[model samples]
Target: MNIFDIPAQAWAGQILIGLINGSFYAILSLGLAVIFGLLNIVNFAHGAFYMMGAMATWMLGNYLGLGYWASMLLAPLLVGLVGIVLERLFISRIYHLDHTYSMLLTYGMTLMIESLFRNAYGTSGLPYSAPVALQGGTNLGVLFMPNYRLWVVGAAVAVCLATWLLIEKTRLGAYLRAATENASMARALGINVPRMLTLTYGCGVGLAALAGVFAVPVYGANPAMGSDLLIVVFAVVAIGGMGSILGSIVTGLVLGLMEGLTKVVYPEASTTVVFVAMIIVLLVKPTGLFGESR
Candidate 1:
């Protein structure tokens, strides 16, 4: 159990795996945070949207010979466009009502979407293999890591950083923040707040779709994938304190790594670690590790 005597390869392998899983949690929770921050909607259908992205990639690949790269780009755009339509057609209608109404509406939308997918694809899981270009592994001195997994982790980190910069350093981000905080004020100042809202929702949904595209090869395309993931993501967001996008990304990766470590010591506790951490976080800092006390 000494530090130098520990199994280095096994430890490195688990860490790599954890980092990859963390990447997914970070990107997914980031999408959730952005939507919640701007729209004030819980977006219960976020998971479904993510699932749809994976399914879209699978269908495109099978029917049109779309590669992973193409689907990675195309799926998000298509799903994002769908989100725009959903915002205009449904989300906009609930803006003036109580929060509960919107939550219920979104929940209903999730159920409908899930049911539709279940009817079409059945409950069984589908097979999805990693693209040939990234199907192998390489030794990194200490451990062998799958190329695709590395890509996923690198992509997620880059995305999270890019998004953080976009929101914190860009003019568009300024406008977005202004419009989100005070739509009427922004509208008076000549900003098209409604259009911005729709676009924001699209972006959020797009991020989810992006996560889905990346996840399909790893997790496969399935209807229940979203609901199951959604619960975990909710915990990630809650623990990270949805007020800050960067916070969400950081917390997700941290929890993901923690879960991985837990798996090494106590396999049975892996699944419970995140929730346990979440509970402890809530007890100590009700708003979360980086959440604001508004």
Candidate 2:
């Protein structure tokens, strides 16, 4: 094979890898968009919560004898509960204050959580194996694809679409949007705005935790793993438009594919491609591709 002639199979594999990464980006950015859109909170600690979810999965498996499937259900719930507590005890208090305060508070929380995990587990990652059933790959004529990766992509897509439908088409989502737009009017109409806010925050964190659970098997659980990816996720959110749910999903997948293509064509630019995309998007559309202009 000529040096410049990349095989079709190789391109397929790279695209698959890009899809997997994009799935993760979509999930993480979706969570951030939901939280920020509904609550107007930046949620700097989201990555930490993601780390906690992965950690929770590992711990559940090692200590509680839970399997991957069980941890899938339990870890997100646990992280979401923690989110509820955080919202009630700390985040809720900062709602009336400047946005900077919330950012600082979440940043501090991220540090504390990361530090705690680092002190306990060190900075190294703990391996989590894929479930026995999903350990192999399927041959798709042109390319062989891992079962676990396919699952990740499918699950992420289902989640993103379901969330969008819930928010855009459902009655409960309508109430949530109403509360987000005008809490006072929502409250006057007998809606419990506070409870909605609390649940929305938990839901956002739960989505992050769900991503973490899916990630542990692929990336392994590490103290700084979330932080390492957090910046990329932020870029995804920015490129997609901060509060635009559909934008987050599409931008994440596109950027992931772009990064994958960059890796094949110009490896040196892969790491910075997403940020570069963000800058370009900002230059062209300051409000973001899907974001409404303020």
Shift in Å, residue 222, candidate 2: 0.4
Q: Tens digit of lDDT per residue, candidate 2, span 1-294?
A: 343788777777778889999999999999999999889899899999899999999999999989999999999999999999999999999887888998999999999999999999999899999899999999988888889989999999899999999999999999999988899999999999999999999999999999999999999999998899899999999988989999999998898888887787778998999999899999999889999974
lDDT of each: 0.88, 0.92
Measured on C-alpha atoms, candidate 1 has an lDDT of 0.88
**Model 1 residue 283 CA deviation in Å:** 1.4
Candidate 1's residue-wise lDDT over 10-119, tens digit each? 67877888898899899999999898877788888999999989999998899999999899999999999998999999999887777798789888989998899899
Candidate achieving the largest TM-score: 2
TM-scores, in order shown? 0.95, 0.97
Off-target runs (Cα >4 Å) in candidate 2 are 1-4
